[model samples]
Target: MAMKSSPVVLKTWYVSIACIMLLSALLLFPVRISLASPAVLVVDDDGFASPTDCDGSDPAYSSIQAAIAAAFPGDEIVVCPGVYSEQVTIGRDGLRVRSFDGSAVDGTPDTVIQPGELTPAAVLITANGVVFQGFYIKDATTGTGHAHVHRGVFVQGDNNVILNNKVEGRGTCRFADVGILVRGGGVGNGVAENNLIENNEVTNTCNGIATVSIATNNAAAYTTIKGNTVKNNLGIGIAADRTPSALVGFNEVTENEIGLKYNSDSEKGLPATGTKFRCNDVYGNEIYDAQNIATDNSIMDAEFNWWGSNTGPDPSKISGSVDYVPWLTAPKEEGCPQKGRMTGGGVLRGEVLFINKTKVSATVNFGFEVHCNNEKEPNNLQINWRVGGQTFIFHLTAMNYAACFETAADQGMPPAPFDTHVGSGEGRLKIGPSPWTPATIQWMFVDDGEPGVGKDIFHAVIIADSTSYVISGKISGGNMQAHPDDP
Candidate 1:
């Protein structure tokens, strides 16, 4: 009877255990992972042990195409310094390929892809959000024609940044392509910013940088052609046709047969509209050449426009081997080329870097100062500064470059009241508030339309209760430049 009772109890215990296990499994079903998104792959010409190695791998792939073939959407394939003798095509969205190191030579013009060996381009992209930075693209002997027959970097995506890379030196084209051609591949929103096409020394090319008609209709809106140094090309150095409100600024186009040209409409005789050419130096262009007539071209708000045939001070003197300062003259130099020069102080030619700021308090104020060599007056050269965001444009002006400015949030307004102050400079001063929290600030020199300029030095002074705040900035819309921080 005792043995029978024990058996019955064991059976009951097993049934309870099974019921508990079933309940736990029902509550803890496995989930499926999402792998449909993009993946970042690696390619080292020298070879990598795995995809992770290619992320920053040494002895990289001998060919960039090899690495590109293995990439997916939202994938970043970083290539090491090597010679790739094949053409590469990137047709996926959110794909980015760059050099392992940040040095220009490391990725800029160093990772050479000879397109002659293949029938297509050295690097051809067709998806949105694809970024190609810091790579050298070239045409090989087997390459069709030097004008690339196509392009060094052909992008057809939106939100793409082709920055700090070199696309140069073409051979021939039965028709003509570009060194860097950006177009809308179906519905991509693309942009080309801060790229260096300098010393590319192109020849027999249609255009150094070409923005075509396809980009106009696609989602790739607002292309910015800035800070590019284009030289020695047969066709237009930079061309934007059928593009929507293209913004071309701060580009140096020199020694080209045709510096800058545009025709927004597809109809040959039609004219383009809504294009901007601001603060660019279009000097030493040979527009007199038969094949290079800058016809139906319109220019606005541009600073320096010196033609090669002009008998004036060489614009190259501003930043060249020769130190000759050309006399500023009105009108043209017999060749009908508009004569111009860098307005305002020579010290304005530098770059600006914004340090990130951390907001400590909801309502806070900030203060900052600028340093200068000379201190004189109520208005010698009008100094203009602008701040704020997309909705509001808060502007401030001063007569001297050595004054400080402050912004205090909680001190004014209501829930987020901010007080702003601008004054003379010297020593350690701050912008914003005391016991300050962090906020973003951007400042630059605005031209008040005057001449007889002297060199000016504008240094940024950050004052806060905490030194751990980060700040970021860039100089916009001025003939002057901001210097980069020392490495």
Candidate 2:
């Protein structure tokens, strides 16, 4: 979205394989996901395309809706790579519908859900405590229904999670409303409270993300919209009001009409009386970065944010009573980030390796860091690997992995990016995701050879967690440089 920030860090902390200390933090901030389900329902587009295209004899479900219909309350559904042409709904509590091999990285998305026919939305949630992740949801502009009902991803349930997905072009056809909406007061739906909408990209809609209530006050309360990029929408990037005490934090809001807004429903007469916006990157809006048309003219807490200017937000860019003091001089950098990725502690650059002459495997082009090394630090590691047709992309924050480098004066090595380095550390080993699925893995690497001349090494072992691999490998192919830290 043309962000001016060079480094993006959002303070992510859901990692660590070295320390038994992470076990305590896991308990303190436990995601409501219980892997103790009866069975995992697998959905793939290999033999199915539509909701009814399931190959019953093949055992795998054909459509997302079919899996939901047959799933139990706590069951987890894993969907493979495909562009699904149907709308989805969930009525079962605690059911997780996730795309198989996708993270927050747009290069490799979870699954694609572009509804063929026009409906109210691409996905609808009336269930509580459901986890919807890893999908690229868009082209859902299919209805003339109410603003609340017409969205890319709409939620009327409580404690639900919307993570690591990209939602764009949502209300283009009819109600230009919201890309993702979390509202309360649905007749049969549960109260939309304490819902976490994190690590998602919302753009090209009327509004990016919103938490609201039409039934009564506090119906859609305490929504946490964090670690997301909200930009290029027609109206508000993030709208939190009508419902009370909603938090909009650690997000990048740019290139929109309004970066952040208070709920302005003249019909309901809700003036966004109580909302808190903090620690966000807000700028590049065509109109205003933050527009608070609160009828009450009450003071809103809009502090700790990066408002495109080190001095502070421009007076004309923000409206109403907003307290925007003590702002960040630069973009926020933590575990997870608002813009440019906060990569690993060291720099990892490499070339490709073709094993069988035809198969393109072992191609590494990424920067990784170990923020999971300490208990209090964020788990932010970014690694990209390709074996055959499969690529594993995950990232952690602040302190997970650790490594050291040998410079020219220190052991006669090359400078920074071209230095000889070796190190090993433990971490949860995920790229871009929630803490729900953590894999305990330890890894080691050596970049001791010349860049482009070959001889870089990489290896990993699944010492703990799920039953996966007792792995090892040898490599000597590179012109790439590896550093223990930035040059």
Q: How far out, in Å, is residue 204 in model 1?
A: 7.1
Q: Could you give candidate 2's per-residue lDDT for residues 1-487 as a string of tens digits? A: 8866433232222233434466654443312244456567778766432223333333466678988887888888888777888899887999988887546346786478888542456888888999999899867544444345347788888889999999877545245567788886652543587788989998888888988776563358667787799887887899886766576777899998889887544456554533567668898898888887665656767866788877889899988877887566666553112221112222223333323233333445444433212232333445555554555554332232232222222212343432222222233443234242344344444444444323444544332244332223334333333433331
In candidate 1, how many Å is residue 16 off? 40
Report the C-alpha lDDT of model 1 over 336-444, residue by residue, as the tens digit: 1111111123322222322234332111111222222113222222222222321111122332212111111122112111012112211222233423233222222
Whole-model Cα lDDT per candidate? 0.44, 0.62
> For model 1, how many clashes?
65
Choose the strongest candidate by TM-score. Answer: 2
Q: Which residue segments of model 1 deviate by more than 4 Å?
A: 1-40, 49-63, 103-108, 117-120, 142-148, 185-206, 214-221, 266-271, 288-487
Measured by lDDT, the strongest candidate is 2
